[model samples]
Target: MSKQYRILGVIISLAIGLAILPIKLTSEDLHSGNLFLAARTIRYTFTAGILAFLLHLYLNRTIFAARWIMVEYILRIIVIALIICLTSIVVDAIFNKFVKESSFTIAKEDLNWYLVILRCLLVSTVQFFVVFYLQLVEESQRRRLEIEKLNRSQLEANLSNLKEQMNPHFLFNTLNTLSAITNDVKVKDYVSEIANVYRYMLIHNKLNLVLLESELSFINSYLYIIKTRFGNSLNINIRIDESILPTKIPPLSLQLLLENAIKHNVASLDSPLAIDVYNDSENIIVSNSLLPKKTNYHSTGVGLNNLLNRYQLLFKQDIIIEQNTAVFSVKLPIIKS
Candidate 1:
């Protein structure tokens, strides 16, 4: 109902309670102290107070969970207003209809809704501040956690970039120096290939994602070095469609996978390691034969973790890794051009 009408009803009830109620109840009724009247007053007061308390708890628990505090606060006010207004109406109706005295006539003042609304606003304001303060504290704590996380991520990204720069550039410069000193064509070409691999890394390491074709070119240079190192013991195959070459992935992803496979597995002439690279409709698959070395190779999970972090940061996507008795494989998601 409209506020004015609600106020009008309260004014009419106020006229009855103030003017008529005194005329209805004389000094004799007041001195007698009727047990029924006292019981009802206690019942209604306790019930209303308890209901408001419960409502406050309910609203605090459920409403404060929302992201926007103002929205929740407004919602609480609306809800509280409706509940209190409706409850006052119900209680007043019950009291007037059910509770009767033989001394007074049928009609008498029941309740003053204006007073109820005032009390509701007062209680609502108190609870709002309490809940709002708690909400503020909670939000402050959440923001602090987020800031801490962001700072940690920034530090890690800086560290990763540092690693990218120092490792690659050092190798690149070292290889260039070796190339200058080399006399033989085979040694010079090998050094050049290694330089090429490091150069590719230095150039693309800053990028969030690289086109598949560019990554594959880097992989080609990287594979040459691996092949030169391992010879016939490593059989690495690539069979990716040209259509998906335009798709994108985090830089160093394939290289990391290849290095992970080579690092963790036993590559020997007696037991050659077979690594395969191909693409399905959704993902690029990297698979290698499982041949664990007896030697304790420290598995820090740096390479795969780096790839996972890069992909998640760039695209909010996860790379799939699977292994069994025979083959260990990873599926890198393809981000379309």
Candidate 2:
């Protein structure tokens, strides 16, 4: 049986044993401090054991079936009481065995089987209350855990949705810039690169992983769009090890880092923001010079928080961020799917 089954058995057993203790103590010979009191108690406890076993069997069947009919409850209590009375009689028989040799004769009469049955019923009712109370507590705990698990799942779903929204928003911004640069035929090849980035994002946005080469190519297309918008004001560079090109990364991760770089820092002709993408050891590092754009609206930190939460769900690691007056950088671990 499972640990839960064992624990439940132990709980029921302890409760029944305690319930029967007072009855055994009040028995005629028990209060007289007879030498065989311990033996009698043990013998009588067998009946309580049988009753407890029956209770477990009945409850195991009824509880999880979502069936709590009044008749079933009444029957279970009756069965439990019968077992207790049977065990009490057995203990009395044993006690009489030792007492037979002595001259102690209290009341010699036929066993009051009806009264014994009534006593069993009363004790069973008490045991039922205790067991029912414990079951309620256990059910409450299970419901609490279920609610917590549901909340966790909902949070993850919400984060995934926000990440999905970000992809299109980023694409719309980039596509708008590409549309404005139609007259510049000299950057046609670069325009194709930007188109390829949108193509990949459109195709693979729902995917969990993409090859590093594919993702980097997408990043280049994305950078092309950013460059078109800022012109000479923004400078971006990439230096990746060819060996790691086949590695897998979460989709649109690099885009979020780039967005953060642009959103927070100034990019202009006077102090052009240079964003770098490269590999150092096992980390994919995106570093940019800290030059805040002299604009009234800076940025809310939600984008990065969403990205960090997304990474945590997928990779179980935080997206490392470092910033100073002159520089700001983020390190994302390259992982294989």
Candidate 3:
């Protein structure tokens, strides 16, 4: 959420208050010295502005939590605004009907619900657009700055990468040689899958997005390596729509989820771990039954956090997480084709 949005709410309300002040004044009213009318006009205008601004801030904070879907966000804003407007009118009507008017809540006859709601809606809608534009600009600038920082970091690491990087060509050649010379067919297949996993990482590490099919293919190879290590103790089921094959996602994103499940859970021949990857209407879901290992496991949460940050920065979407004693699930939004 933007701190500027919160701070600007009061400032904008004050501005609106002042803007509506001139409309409140008339030559005859000023000449006649209608102090009560003057005070009521100013009070009502400022109160409405302040109320709307506060509501804007609260709703903006609540709804726009790392998930910046434009359509949904705008719809929510409009819906909440209408609700607040209607609620205000009903409350005012109730107060007028039941409560005695003294110093405050005076000039009930002068209050026009239609005009007041219209004015509030107009001012609030304009202010919302202004703040939303500012937020978008701030986010764009922040993203650019981050990208520049990452570029600088990559440059600094270039020398280290050169020194530490194993030549992929040589590694592939060696793996192919081992696979060719292996006496056992299973060992040959295992060697080939290991090569595939490494090759996918080397090829797609720098890419921002890859087709789901490509990522899933890489995952299959990666899973082969894992299954070889865990044997029948681990089972992975992936059922994705073929139509979604063209959809894009951050490369290696699913690997992080799969890795987390394998790392944290108890997977043995008995009570084998089951990890399921499937897709619904708009999202891909990864789910597993809850099975915590007895051994103390320290979690830094880097993998999932890294995945989350990438999605927010790249897609402006938040991954939905749901967990219980029985199952843990994450719904990852799929990028449109």
Candidate 4:
């Protein structure tokens, strides 16, 4: 509803309540001779109009909370009654010159102005609560929308990070294999391994997950390139069960772990490195013996961090990492398609 219409509605409701107050207050039937009744009605109309405008300000603008509803209602009742009674007495005194005033007073009989004030209080309290409830509902909906927006932004950031990591990893390994092939005479086998590895990485790197068998075959082709380059030094053992070959796993996940192993560990013909790949109870396991490479440059630790971030983005679960005196292992959960 428009603001103007809502303001008009409040005015109409107050006018009706003020109009009815006089008839309800009179002990006898409402009649023309009852000057007091008419005067009281005019006084109430002025008081209620002022109170309604003040209430609109309080309900919409005030930051204070009503901790004690009963106390608030009682105070409002007292204030409205005092304002109306004072206005009525002044209006009666002013009308003495223009018209005759009623002399039949109710000093002998007892009256309770508190009851009428309480009735007005109940109506005002109900209006306040309705407005408060609607505002709370609007705030709740706004917060929910904000949370969804944050989640979408986080997912986009993770996807971009994962995309960026795959390219450099493939480039460095391919170039290294090419450099090794320059000195050796195994051109045909080296070229074949490079072709197979590049073809698979290009096709699957952008995807979130691929079948366990497909990822394994890609990892095997990658290991082939690494092994051909390192020749007699890189030892890889696969212990996968054929039963879960169709399950889904993150694309190029195994290749990343294998790269980390080769980058950080020592591997030569004299002390050949051992790397193991297997699956156990819905997880892919990659473990390698610790033999730090003295000649390699220090890494900035982006590979493992990238893997952790991607796993959290896709699964909302932590990948298990365990390291001890002789071995370091990582366990990745398999997500079934």
lDDT of each: 0.70, 0.70, 0.73, 0.66
Q: Name every residue pair that clashes in candidate 2.
A: 266-291, 266-292, 266-293
List TM-scores for all candidates, in order.
0.57, 0.51, 0.58, 0.49
Q: For model 4, state the Cα shift of residue 21 in Å.
A: 22
Q: For model 1, what is the error of residue 242's alpha carbon versus the real structure, in angstroms, after optimal superposition?
A: 2.1
Candidate 1's residue-wise lDDT over 242-299, tens digit each?
9999888877789889988998999999999999999999899999999988896689
Arrange candidates by TM-score, descending: 3, 1, 2, 4
- Can you tell me which runs of candidate 2 are displaced by over 4 Å? 1-184, 187-191
**After TM-score superposition, what is the CA distance of residue 75 in candidate 2 from its true location, in Å?**
43
The weakest ten consecutive residues by lDDT in model 2 span: 101-110
Q: Write the per-residue lDDT of candidate 3 for residues 1-337, one digit (tens) a residue.
A: 5676566766776676567534444454455355545554445455556666666655665554456667666665566557556655666566556645443353444466666566556656765665676667777888898787545544433443356567889989999899888899999989989888877877777777899999999999999989999999997899999988999998778987998898899999999999999999899999998898888679987667667767776778899989999898989998995
For all candidates, the clash counts are: 0, 3, 0, 0
RMSD of 2: 12.7
> Residue 85 CA error for candidate 1 (Å)?
8.7
Record all residue pairs in model 1 with backbone atoms less than 3 Å apart, i.e. clashing. Answer: none
Residue 286, candidate 4: alpha-carbon lDDT: 96
Whole-structure CA lDDT of model 2: 0.70
- Of 1 and 2, which scores higher on TM-score? 1
Error of 3 at 72 (Å): 21
